[model samples]
Target: MSLMPDRKTIMLVLKDVTQENQYKREKLEQERKFIEQTRMAQMGEMISMIAHQWRQPLSSISATSMNMMIKIQLGEYNLETKEGRDECENSFVGQLEKIEIYTQNLTTTINDFRNFYKPNKLPVLTSLKSVVEKSLKIIEGSLHNDNINIIYDYNFNEKIELYDSELMQVVLNIFKNAQDNFKEKGIEKPLIKITTKERSLIICDNGGGIPEEIMKNIFDPYFSTKDEKNGTGLGLYMSKTIVEDHHKGSLHVDNQEAVEGEGIGACFTIKLNLSSQSMEG
Candidate 1:
């Protein structure tokens, strides 16, 4: 009689990843929508800044055009004699140059605002100082109108890879917050000091310090100290995300007992490191 081998057994396993993938997709979609919302919320402030930047240039252009028209109407330029013609030519050329300069100023202002709204496609080699300067240029007019002073102290200017436009947004957020605080508190001689150190950018404003109890929640999404009508509460949250999640950096704040000898205020620090991939570039 032949002996038969015992029957062999086999096992198989299957997993359903549909729910997991769906959850990921939902989270991503939510983040994308929130980013757009944040941009829209900032649009009002952006428009205000553009108006501030354009006002002076537009006024200058108008004045120059009026002056040219008046001169032509009144026959102020003697065009008969050779010498008179030379003088008229020189005057018109000077006026034209002024108009050109004013027009260029208008163009630059628009470009700055346009670039601020444009999303970056690639990381750029830049420095914290450079980014800070660009951000300041955009808001400086508004600050001047508000009588807010900016003191910039440079210590580190090393080049690093970053999404410069995104970083600019973070800087602008901090600056706008400081300005609002100054206005709200009615701080006298309002001042904001910016300092760049080894891999860190620090901004401090003498607008009274943030309350310790509420400081912890500042980075949480949709948390705001301002009234509902004034604050969408996404600025700091988006800023923290840009610095930490997108750039792989760190952002923190503290109550500075004294900032540049200007008394107690809120201070924000942004620390960045070169990414592994960017190090070679």
Candidate 2:
């Protein structure tokens, strides 16, 4: 209606545009920070997982070798004649078996990290139970230290058909969140339970439940109960994307349990398609 532009009108238009750009820049930065945070968190988780995976076998290897050395010192090993060859062979074979177990685990760890950190690909038939198992193994140390017991109620009948690495990331994210949440709340006995049947589900910690408002925004990017220094709010959001977009699955969180663990804290449910070969599942 007013074709003739006034100084106030021009100033207002410029202000609006500036504000819009600022908003976009902030959003972009938040997104970048979120991505960087995800990468860092993943790397940290992997490092810890590797250490945990290697810890037990390494300890066993050390102990076994020490035991063997002590036996040799006490003339427990017989190698004086040809008749002693069989005994020596048996003992060395046992040691070799232990070494083989350690090597096999090391190889599996390398492969798991490789698959996880590799570039994204389409979904395929992956063992869902195994994927989550690897993730749990990765964080076992932390779980033990926090007195957090993880209960895995799953049927290992069929391999879960989904994006293997993506599914793992989803599982890891939920587990880390559970552990962190429990620690933050200072709970004495933290418990995380994972169940997989028709759908893969994980439940953890029965302390403070998520608020109504936060529940609505749980899947929204940059929505976090943690402070800026602690959390970026992208973990769950990215998990949702990985499950829904990449893996053709779904991830959801409920504040209360449907049956048992009622009045408990948060529970996360993830549903994924069974691999083509998995007919019964």
TM-score of each: 0.89, 0.71
- The digit string of per-residue lDDT tens for model 1 on 26-130 reads 988987887887889888888899899989988988998899899889998778889988988898899899999999988898898888888998998888888
Question: Highest lDDT: which candidate?
Answer: 1
Error of 1 at 213 (Å): 2.3
Off by over 4 Å in 1: 1-17, 260-262, 276-281
Best of the candidates, TM-score: 1
lDDT of 2 by residue, 164-236 (tens): 6666778888888887787888865667777766656555557566777778898988777887766777889
Candidate 2 versus truth, CA RMSD in Å, comes to 7.8
Stretch of 10 with least lDDT, candidate 1: 272-281
Candidate 2 is scored at a TM of: 0.71
